[model samples]
Target: MYVTTSGRIHNFGAGPATLPLQVVEECQNALPNLNESGFGLMEISHRSETFQEIIDSAMGRLRRILTIPDEYTVLFLQGGASLQFYMSALNLLRPGDHVDFLVTGAWSQKAMKEANRIGDASPRWDDSENGFKSIPKNGEYSIRNDAMYVHYTSNNTLFGTQYHHLPDSDGKPRVLDASSDIAGVPIDVSAHDLIYAGAQKNLGPSGVTIVILSPWAMKRVGDDLPTMLDYSVHSSKGSLFNTPNTFGIFVLDRVLNWVEENGGLEGSVARNIAKSNLLYEELDRSSFWKPHAKKDSRSVMNVTWRLPNEKLEEKFLQEATIAGLGGLKGHRSVGGIRASLYNGCSIKSVEALVIFMRNFEQANH
Candidate 1:
């Protein structure tokens, strides 16, 4: 086996982001023989008591951290947040029923497209012409009172926009795709009828998606649905309808434990705010950089900005890589630099990035 290095680079990737070093070290120690089970974690059977305990621990910790109400059921499933786009429509909507979507960015637009295949999904309001720079204000959309549910993305990873406050659904059921900023942000769990997140950004890793649903939302799941696509089936079976991602759940368990120990959602949010503020402050202070999203709708988790020109942005990323920074490249849809400060990204890393930014600006200017 190759020996690992002592110091780690500051990672700013959008997804499959950095994980807490403590959680990674704990997983490493347990991988060889989990809980003294006499077998490696990957070798253990999912039905074994060892695996059962792991899943149960993960679920319990997530509930404690999020303060999820007892009436809501949490399921750890395979597909990422992308699957929930259509699954939400299939479960709660029929051919005639309609679902309203707030199209703020690329992910929500994809969700609405998927929902359209299932039912009469329509965009209540779209801000694409403005380059998805900000979220629509309250009462800006013409919501149909008879719609089945309103779908929105809590954070748009591609465009770097976030909703600081959730929309007033007008008593209609709210379906949120919170894949990018779920555990990193504090939320009112009771306010949403259904919420789903892919466990790659802030939670743990990919391959596991957490779906939390209220009792009323579960009741609306369509009958005769395929076993795999049915939320009610997964909830009834306790997210063990099929073989689950045992390793993913194990890592998630450790991550949630870390979150709770560090002060739960509130603590995560505080850390993220500090990191984002540090970077944004430097960006705003310099004329060499230009932020993508509006100040009011900027994402605390992902800060996207452009340099004076593409050549400078390329040079900055190349030099930043040599200086032990990684994943500073922006998304393909929008060309720029993006720094994703997930829960695991430390303040030290953000400070280093800001220092590098200032140096680069000074040298170039």
Candidate 2:
């Protein structure tokens, strides 16, 4: 396994992925006595004033970094993006309401299935037959005229595909599950009515999910919704309707602080692009590297590919783990190899990966 002199591995897991060393160190420091308040990071009371300050800072920094509209409401909740898959539909949709989904990958397919529980959810565009290799262009699908909203996943972690442009929603509201590529790529916050992402990938650790909602989305929320699933309830109480993931929120805040200090969203986007380009360059250099996603649909955050055969792929993963290039294995559903380059991943890690890839190719070929 490849180990840095600092004793850290080059992490490339999809979710709960890499984090900035600085953030991790800060969390370590805070764990003993948070803000010198005689409270451990994980033991602090969620209702305490100090903890309140941490959550407030996190929300404010996220808004600034994402350039969220002043009118939009941001909530930090638990249960990850999976819960949001159901809660978003529960809150924004009603019985018999029609919703169109652009099923680019596995996550969107799940999102559509959850939405179908509440309303008529139809796939406006599904790429499953094509192995989810590419995203659709604007005119590639038709949104139902009476659709209540359009739902999509901005990035497909399982398939290494991403939408480079905002999807066409036919002027209807858009809901996005941006679990894998939220802050690592360019996104138009104002364009989406509702957006949810689990913090494990680009933002921080697991357990905390970020939800951003426009005024229209809040306005559209049906009455008498379940308290925990209701956006309005969570927004009204500032996401403190119930006890939250204190440690995760604190870590997330530190991650956002790191992002702000390192040139904010623009810096992350450029770095991610550079990292993916390095891997894609090596992939294109030889037919031995078989990338899963098409060129225009390649994801900057999660890069997936295969070897010439299953045996070689297994050999590659074994050697990769032995070399300390960790978390290079792909999702089990479509196993091959995947390298996730989230916001906290550095260019140095990418460089190491490329060098190792070249060496491996030479030895194996």
**lDDT value, candidate 2, whole model:** 0.92
Compose the digit string of candidate 1's lDDT tens values, residues 1-365: 11125477888999899999999998898889999998797888898999999999999999988889998999999988989888988898888788999998899999999998888888988999999999888888878989889999999898899999979787788999999999898898999999999999999989999999999898998899998999988888889989999999999999999999998889999999989989989989977899999999999988999988999989999999988889899998879999999998989889888988889998998
Candidate 2: where is the Cα deviation over 4 Å? none
After TM-score superposition, the amount by which residue 263's alpha carbon in candidate 1 deviates from its true location, in angstroms, is 1.3
lDDT (CA) for every model shown? 0.90, 0.92
lDDT of 2 at 193: 96
| Pairs clashing within candidate 2 | 1-322, 1-323, 1-324, 2-323, 2-324
Total colliding residue pairs, candidate 1: 0
By TM-score, how accurate is candidate 2? 0.99
Candidate 2 local lDDT, 289-353, one digit each (tens): 99999999999989999988999989988888788788899998778999999998899988988
Residue 41, model 1, lDDT: 77
